[model samples]
Target: MRWSIEVFFKEAKSLLGLGKSQARDFASQIASISITVLQYNVLGTVKRFKSYETIGGLFHEATDGAVQLSVTDRIWGILQELVMIIAEAFQIDDERVMDTLINRSETFKHFINLDKLELKQAA
Candidate 1:
């Protein structure tokens, strides 16, 4: 029990900066401590659900999962797959199909942010 308390204090200070607030006023310091405790509770809850062995490990894993592809990347992937399917169906070169689509469809270009130069490179 004592060891667990020590671990909590150590991790709370090291990971959450529990006492690092430079606020000179008593109320501000209390608020800062409250925020730190809240952060610790949130992380603890996540750790409980995720079964992470240590606070540091959970912190790193949580941060690593934050990265995601943007809207443009998803749209570009869908467009590439569609172009490939059309090329396969028509027995035409992918580049040729892509050129035709880019040249003729003003709406497609406007929606997808693709140009002939980019289409050439992508194909």
Candidate 2:
């Protein structure tokens, strides 16, 4: 399903307590990661459903009740692996990119919100 950028920013800003500029920055980072993930998903470097569902489920499960550092850290680790694979495929600096992307809490918030929305809409 196609996600609307405006909706992403709106939900992310609210959930992550991010300002518009920060939300935009986070959104950009997510877009880049998503593109890389999609590439990997298509190329069979990553299992489309397995990777996407795991990452997506992590966010939902993490946010369903309380938001904790441990949960967030675990989710971060999963994303880090995904990012590393993408970076390796394209010969880029995985650590630097992953570090930057993981800190964007707004991006994660949007991811969860969008995934929830997609699922609900599908149902």
lDDT of each: 0.84, 0.60
Q: How far is candidate 2 from the true structure (C-alpha RMSD, Å)?
A: 21.0
lDDT of 1 by residue, 1-123 (tens): 999789888998988788999989999999999988887788888888875667888766766876967788888889889999999998989889888997899997785565666788988
Model 1 segments beyond 4 Å from truth?
A: 63-123
RMSD per model, one decimal: 9.3, 21.0
Model 1 pairs in collision: none
Q: Which one wins on lDDT?
A: 1
lDDT of 2 by residue, 1-123 (tens): 246456444444553333423335767767755654453334332325455544334435546766555776888688778998999998999987766675677886687789899999999
Model 1 is weakest, by summed lDDT over 10 consecutive residues, at 108-117
Which lDDT value does model 1 have at 68? 67
Residue 63, candidate 2: how far off, in angstroms?
23
